[model samples]
Target chain A: MIGKLNRNSTLLSSIISIILGMLVGAIAMLLSGYDPISAYGALFSSVFGSASDMGETLRTITPLIFAGLAVALAFRTGMFNIGVEGQLVIGSLAAAFVGLKLELPPVLHAIVALVVGALAGAIWALIPGLLKAIRGVHEVIVCIMMNWIALFLSNYMVGKVLSNNSDSTEKIHPSASIRVDFLTDMFDGARVHLGLILAILTTIFVYVLLFRTKLGYELRAVGLNPDASEYAGMSVKRNIILSMMISGGIAGLAGAVELLGTSEYLAINPSLPGTGFDGIAVALLGANTPIGVVLSSMLFGGLFNGGSNMQYVAEVPFEVIRIVFAAIILFVAANFVKQLGNRKNRKKKGEKASA
Target chain B: MLSTMTNLLETTILYSTPLILAALGGLFSERSGVINIGLEGLMTIGAFTSAVVAINTGSPWIGLLAGIVAGILLALIHAVATVTFNADQTVSGVAINFLAAGLAVYLVKALYDGAGQTPVVESKFTDLAIPVLKDIPLIGDPLFNTSPITYIALILVFVSYFVLYRTPFGMRLRAVGEHPHATETAGVSVVKMRYVAVLISGALAAIGGATLSTSIGSEFSATTVAGQGFIAIAALIFGKWKPFGVLGAAAFFGFSVALSLTGQVWGLTEYVPSEILTMLPYVLTILALAGFVGRANAPAAIGKLYERGSR
Candidate 1:
């Protein structure tokens, strides 16, 4: 019972860490001579003041949900897929390519574009996964390299081939769009689309696949103790590949959603979309859980969407929001470190008593 | 034709200086069992700090020192998180990276009343010809007629090789990375060694960043460091984490950069797309990482948190 209580306290402690993260940001605001209260007020008002505001927030949440789910799934499988951003760019480009090039029927066009986008993401992730499994290369290094490669590849594709003389590709066909007329009308002509529904359903599907399924058991088992799982006859290599592919596919879906539901064109991006990097913070804050990821992603989406208002009203730079996000990750990691220290002390005490 | 060859060599040398320094920095930290993925962030801070200071103090040398100090400050945060609190190294690294990028931009806004970049410094580390070497045949102009930072970067490679291989402290550093338990049993402080290694890494990486702002780019922008720090990390891995190997890998990467830049200068831009040329170095890095070239092993306890009195 005490052990269980201790675990609950740790969860509470994470909440406290989050609050502390906000406090740190507030302190920074104060140091910059900006009123924290008004800043936060503006932030909230921006995200929740109107239906259209909520629509914008939801639009931001759509991709974040997919990206966060991608990170969470991979984290649970004990692989840090830092290549999510790269995969996302690849996936978005693929979706854009298909959406622009293909002449499929309306319903079939959108589906095929999304599927192909996910396929491209999976293929991009497979390089790192296979390298890690077969060549003993660190996934982080490979992923970092691949991220740049993807950027360049996407830039090249958008500039040389798909582009209609501009740096961005031609507008994707309307048939391949994920826009919903009723939803757009409901949001007062806001940019919200069917991607929100798709994101929520993907979250539910991911949760079920992670918890209710046998494959999840093997994956989780391998994550916990790969050596033990190997002894139990699990193919760790195959699972690593599969986990990365799934993670990449989900990240790819985020790209497709962003393209089909929002932009409808692929632009030559000099830098990453940053959604995938944001997903790391989301996964960390969410404790790598599906429901937790959705909640935390919503919070982050609001922060991002509302940052502009905070900037306009409070005269605080939008960069402060990024600092706050960093602080949150920092405090959480610090809390984790403290917990690790406690566990080590307890283990030492147990050993001493045994001796 | 000879001049073009010399020009390529000069460009390669200039480009490799920062990579060499940053890779050498990463070598020290990872060798001591802490992965410093925040190299990019550290470099950014360094670039920003050095540029701002150089503008204020009117001395590139002072700016260089300021950059090193800034790097050490950030590295100390990482060391505290990883060594004291025993946080996950990579996550901590990511956080540090984000913090640096954000903090640098925030500071730029605070100090300069704007974001995106710092004011340009008038004083930069310009290239100077060596007394006698500049007059020599083919090699002199490229090899010796360079900025002081280039010389420092090259000399430091040997200096790091000596300190990391020949010194007693180096042995303990390697031992702690491989077997901290044994090192602790031998009365060496694992935490202190790790702190020293991490701090050194920060200093060198900062120097690399300072070199960029002070000489290479002549100013500090939000994208000044870009992905060079990561490329340095890849170079370090490709070099098998050795000082001389890092020098070679940095040069190789530098050569690729020079080649891409040269294509346009040589009026071959229409023949080969600059984007394709730009993609070559990254593709090579991925291929090298996939063991298409060879293999390199990391330190045994590279990412592990050392706990005292544990099995």
Candidate 2:
């Protein structure tokens, strides 16, 4: 269904979804006896308020884009990798382990840590993807279960292997850090790093990988119709695993950047870091396009970054932003515009159904 | 040793009540042809309302009722979006979760002067040993010495089974999920059935959350429900959409959770790492799904949109 839309209509529908989401948010604010205008004003200024704020916002957007792409890639392959959060956790743990424990030179160290993290993520996803391919198990259930498993495993990692604190590990080596000193100084002490550049490069790479390559065509074809693709001599099972692994790698990158670039250490938490579920919203909102994923994640990044300011400046709670995003996703999911288009093409689709 | 066994059983029953309730909730919704990953959201709303109302009214019953109503109200959005608007059910479910989560914290903050959690409620249910049954041996203690909600939940599985397999409504609801087109041709309103099922799903799942807040825990916090709703969904699938199957699955999961913490169940904790023990339920769930049980067969049209006149 996502593949059916032209680029322009996809953009138009997304804009409509965002508008609807904002309208719902405004109404929620008003009904709560809060001024929506002031809340929105605070939200705007929160991102544009200062150079540091802008840096933080960019940093926030980076992980979301990676997570969104992870979701979008699987979504395009007719798979729902609900385990992106699990993948992220494993990846982050791996990257943190490498960054903190291993001693190597600057650039090579970071690269090795990143590669290991992405591989960890891929391995984490491999379970569900293989199950889906070989045993016909639905990815949703396994992925959801894997999320809790990841939490426990990461907690153990933090507690046992790298416990400088009860709930957190020691910081990574500076050589393995992604944050550039020049960038930090430019942003007035912001911890914003080159992760945004990595995210953008990934976006471009994936866009090419998914659209411009024959392998991309094969992956998408399996997603659109696996039986037909198989009839066309494509190995459906292999493609499913391959797509899932690639998506898992990207999701791992999200965690790697988050830890290596932002936290520089791992923390043991009872809950997920939460990007996987949000990735579902980002991918849906972005219409599952690479460029769209980046754009939509920026919107999410801005909302999340601005939420505290909204709370402080307008006396509205930060959670109100979740409501807005939820509304946007609903609008996008219930795309009446797509229905209108579907109605127009029904004759062709109906004939094909019969044929 | 017998007493220790009984205590473990009691803990399992207490923990399993919410899972059983929530899985049954999933049973109703999925059997009616609508996907409801929003059980977590519904439970959250239920839990928050239950906690708040219990605090204000000093009556757990009223709070519980109010929680159910809140869940039903929130579920109405899901019903409208999926049945009325033909929205993607999974996406709609995700939205429902976001709405519930945001609304819960948002309201808590608004009501409590920016406090992150609710104060403990004194009126919540406490564990009870049934008068007649308490006199019985080890078996009776395990079976009866539990939260009253556990007994209600135990009875509910049979009730759910009867309702799903015995009643005319059950047949139509199943038909609606499996083949809405056929159900429609038989002069039944697929939309109405889905709405009823979803509301019931919301109510039960909410009660599950309320059970956690009011009975198991002393208060409502963001993490109180934790991922129990998702666990309930896993139980639903693990149970293969059957009430009795879900009861057993939930009990097993609850047992895993209950024993994993203390390692008193066969003293496994002595040998196993606490982390490994904690990971047991999820790992076991995956193994169960991948093993001889094979794939869980959902309703034929579980995730598909049911258009009235279109194929």
Candidate 3:
């Protein structure tokens, strides 16, 4: 497999994977005695039901976009940052701490909280990156361990250090909140905030960083062929650590955005957040590209938003979305349509090979 | 203090059984040139199967068998995808984890009148005390007076060590992982070896799940297999992929888990928060890999797709 996928081939494979995933999900629903049509109908219809629905859908998409970008960046840099869940929680904790404890001007408070949160996530990721670069430890093993540590540490801090008489911290000060009153009014009181605008801006920023910058070129070169990059006088270790920190920063930003714009506080989480895990599927489906991640996140965000509707209308658990995504991931991995890609490329003067 | 030590040892052995079983399973797959990160998913399915079957049939033994069969079926998918189609093993593994996590809970809800967890099975493994062994002052109670599964798991470690190191099949398995092309030239069917290894890996990992549900945990829930599958992987790395080493590593992890709880009783929680205490196993895993153990000595051909054309 080459380091990057050809656009035409990737588009075809992604479509086929989504179709196959839906088919399998349908079969599963039928076997379970649930009505697949009604369930799926309820899922999408809910996303388009009203202005409020649209706003809520945007809210769901916000964190996923950040998460997808985080995963995509790491994928581009030849590392699997599965510790995103840990980083996100730690970032949220940091943001909540900042938002609650600090006093600052309205614009400055939110900005400062966001920066601190992203830095928290970056620091969490730095450990595994450093270990992989310096000690030759597998990043996956260390990341998985860190996920648990992050969870427990955050859980302790949330319940003991941050609790304001209940399971969650007190709502953040209004100065630190990213809630946009005009957007809220337009969406009929839905909690749509500045996070969506931030998401789109970040996507464009990632595109420019990866495609039009010297550092991005060096980082991806190291990812594709570390030995060759090292021979070319690039510092592979430094690149590895740098990319991990950036990926982690985005992951932290995801947590920070959700805390500031939506949840507005931190709660005791019993399990690792699924959004961090979902980033893997998003990146893979997007072919690890910036713009592609936004599109993929949009699709996933719709499915997830409609999940509650599926529960209410068709009596199916929202978890079916996970199963469908899992199947899609499997199909993507198998690359069943690679032959199609190969055949199409054969007639071209310069054909790109695929994984 | 001796009594406390014995109690702690008892808890350690009690908890380590599942890790020993799962890590041993991981050894087989990695030894045959496949990376099986789906141990968590396989265990989740196993835990679900055993819980459901045991609740229905009133026999944990039958439940255990069904769990194993379920694991083999799921592993066949992994084998076909990764071994036959050359899919990325890690991708396949991540897919399996999500699939199992969602499916088991969904099925439980469907089968149990919308309940989120399986009803606790009435037919559970009873703790046993080997008569004479149980009488030995300190070691006996801690080591011998526990579930029968613990004894079987300990015995299997030596059995696994012998099978991997001394037996012809074991040698062939290791050879494929180390040098599949050489093994292919020598007339061993690399594909068949890998398929067998992956399937065995699934079965043993399932047993680990079964141990949790029927032998120890008593029920299947969304959190039943939680992160035990991942912990088993850490144990595999800590053990350095050797059978005896794996056994020791699994035991060490189990001790960490047990100590997380027992330390509270001993007033150690006064210094360390309970949540921090619970993080011991995970933290130790990272620490060991980073500096204490240095690099992991993974099999040479692990995570690589063996293309017959290249061979």
Off by over 4 Å in 1: A1-7, A336-355, B267-271
TM-scores of all candidate predictions against the true structure: 0.95, 0.95, 0.94
Output the better candidate (1/3) by DockQ.
Answer: 3
lDDT (10s digit) by residue, model 1, range B112-178: 7755687777999988788898878888988888989999999999999999999999989988888
> In candidate 1, how many Å is residue A149 off?
1.1
* Total clashing pairs for each candidate: 0, 0, 0
Per-residue lDDT of B1-311 in model 2, one digit per residue for the tens?
A: 77677777877887899999999999999999898989999999999999999999998888899999999999998998888889988879988988999889888887888889999899998668888987788768777777777888888899999999999999999999999998899999999999999999999999999999899897887788888888898899888889998999999889878787546456786687678876777877787788755556888889889878998
Q: Local error of candidate 3 at A56, Å?
A: 2.2
Better of 1 and 2 by lDDT: 2
Residues B1-311, model 3: lDDT tens digits: 88788878988998899999999999999999888889999999999998899999999889999999988888888888888778888778888889888888888877887788888788988888899989999899888888888988999899999999999999999999999999999999999999999999989999999999999889999988888888898888888889998899899888887887787789877788778767877777787787674555889998888978694
Query: Model 3 segments beyond 4 Å from truth?
Result: A1-5, A164-167, A339-355, B1-3
TM-score attained by model 3? 0.94
Clashing pairs in 3: none
Which residue pairs in candidate 1 collide?
Answer: none
Fnat of each candidate: 0.63, 0.76, 0.70
